[model samples]
Target: MTEDRKKGNSSKWRPQTMMVRGGLTRSEHGETSEALFLNSGFVYDSPEEQSARMAGDKPGYIYSRYANPTVRMFEERLAQIEGAEDCRATASGMAAIHTMLVAPIKPGDRIIAQRQLFSSCLWILKNLMPKMGVEVTWLDGSDLGQWEDATRKPCRFALIETPSNPLLDAVDIRAVADLVHNAGGELIVDNVFASPILQRPIELGADWVVYSTTKHMDGQGRTLGGAILGKTSKIVDELQQYYRHTGPSMSPFNAWVVLKGLETMDLRVRRMSDNARVIADRLATNPKIKAVRYPGRSDHPHHNTHASQMPEGGGSMLAFSLKGGGDAAFAMLNRLGLIDISNNLGDAKSLITHPATTTHRTLTEHERAAIGLDDTWVRLSVGLEDPEDVAEDVEQALAGR
Candidate 1:
């Protein structure tokens, strides 16, 4: 282990400073940028040294599947910014979610989650967990009564994503964390929407926090990555074994790319969030739009909760419903010239997607309707583009409708 990792000096610095210089360790050659240790394995000075490392008597890299210097730098930098004691990087956001849920659970354990989740997450809880003999329960995330009632019985774990996907519904993290803990369950918060720059779930009492670093962390629609953050014991002891054996490891190159991306994440997220607020406000007034959902907006159903938890900004995402349903939604999307029609979000370019068709297409109409996803609803991931330009493009599209 490097002294830099041990000391974690970045923790004392502010978030922007940490992103730029945190977890920085230089090789003997003293490179300015973080070195990418691309090799699959490392060498030991002697067989005795290798034995000690394998036996846990000494700390050093063994295999890329387990750890690498470049990946560790990324993990440490993110952990510092998140205020987590430790962090582990994975191949993708889904991989991080899978590891966090699967590592500390066993067959027949009970898991409770909010119903409004990303499509892949819904699949895992609804389909995969049951096949693994894990009991899963779903509830409306914004309803505290539902959370309190369901957690009355003991459970192994509980998970929720605040400002939920597509809808931007907010949940009380502190309240949920208390309920889950009282029921002998650990709380795992998916903080992708409210990035570390916006919200820190650990400070709100969540036991574990996970992110698809592919989103705001990369902030450029480049390289895929995910991360899990929590106490050192939980990661090094409970989750590390499963992570190593399953080989859902992040590539050194991707880690390095994201490490560089972190340097500008704070600036990009703030600017993008400002742009989203401007666009969402404009959408709210348009007669053609039925509703606009932005956590920063006062009319949002959970605006108070969002204000309390993420006062920094409402986040760079917004969703609105058009009066014309799917056809009108598609027409507006086709008419927009400046924004790209891509499902991917948190990019430098504004992108939009129809949740009912693109992201949640697999779900039955009944299932989609239950979560407030309709053909007319469109989710927009505001990017670091000029707010006026994005608004102009949207206005022209809506004018045609």
Candidate 2:
């Protein structure tokens, strides 16, 4: 079955079927769902076999850190969906990003990244990587010219996120991939905001993709996990050593949860994205809204690029700011009886957060201004709720007594 799948000869099976049944390795019990293996290490039948496995002369799981049956199923299933040859699950999303960047580059390496990213991700580039003697540069991702200009000097890596967090802004993946590749750099995309259901960065020319499975993949917010997917050689050869030694492995239980989450991810993401589109439209026409940004809208800065990149409607996240100010925004958040105030996204429950105060709060006020995160700005993660209820909550919240 694995051989057939790798060759793309699976008889045109739909994505939903692949999600449910792909990468199954049943034991003697013949379980319908994938079974969990909770042991720290696998035993070899003979001492010689163990030695061969240790020397990379055999094929099988050795230690949980390097590989586990449960984690392998999740990684293979994710790789299948993303159309990548290999994948590795990490302890968290930042670990995946850090491992991928740090494994390949040495001292004096340079990385060019988009200015807008999750605050922790920004810290990795601006603060963490620089401490290791790597040079990091930030550019406006929406402008292809800026990307081109930045890469002209040659860099080791280029990273970006599309329909970026909090802002819902976009960077053209394929175009930037070309720019990075022409300069001999690897392109890595953080595809957390647009889950695999809504986007496939690999097909669009990304050399690798990363996900915070804790977000949309788990869908219910049950567990914390992350994954890195890319070409097989990169994973097994380059990243495998770094991953095994550093020990940021995903737990078997979390992998099992991620596998189950994959089954319903498509349905949840579609409905939530639809609700988000409706909410974005309704809020755009209101008198209290200074600006509304949803990639699904025709007026969005990158509507044309989005049309070419994402044929589906804009994803399940959007951001808006009140014309009145932070006080008004707080009143709206306070009035919310339906949407929960939280930092997490892509949960079963609708969530909203003031990025300036919560997610991006660590950045200075001037830095927040640079990224369009103001006290008045609120990022909404639309969930599997009736569109009317979500919109009504926003409507009432905007009106102050």
Error of 1 at 282 (Å): 1.3
Off by over 4 Å in 2: 1-12
lDDT of 1 by residue, 131-235 (tens): 889999889999999999999999998989988998999999999999999999999999998899898899999999998989998888889999999999888
Candidate 2 lDDT tens digits, 1-401? 46554333253567877777667677777677789999898889999999999998999889999889999889878888888888999988888888988888888888999888888988888777878899988888898989989989888889898879889888999999999999889999999988998889999999999999999999898999999999998787778889999998999999999988998888999898899999999999999999888989998777887777878868889999899889888889998989999999999889999998898988898888887778888899999989899999999888753
How far off is model 1, as Cα RMSD? 1.9
Q: Best candidate, lDDT-wise?
A: 1
RMSD to the hidden true structure, all candidates = 1.9, 2.0
The pairs that clash in candidate 1 are none
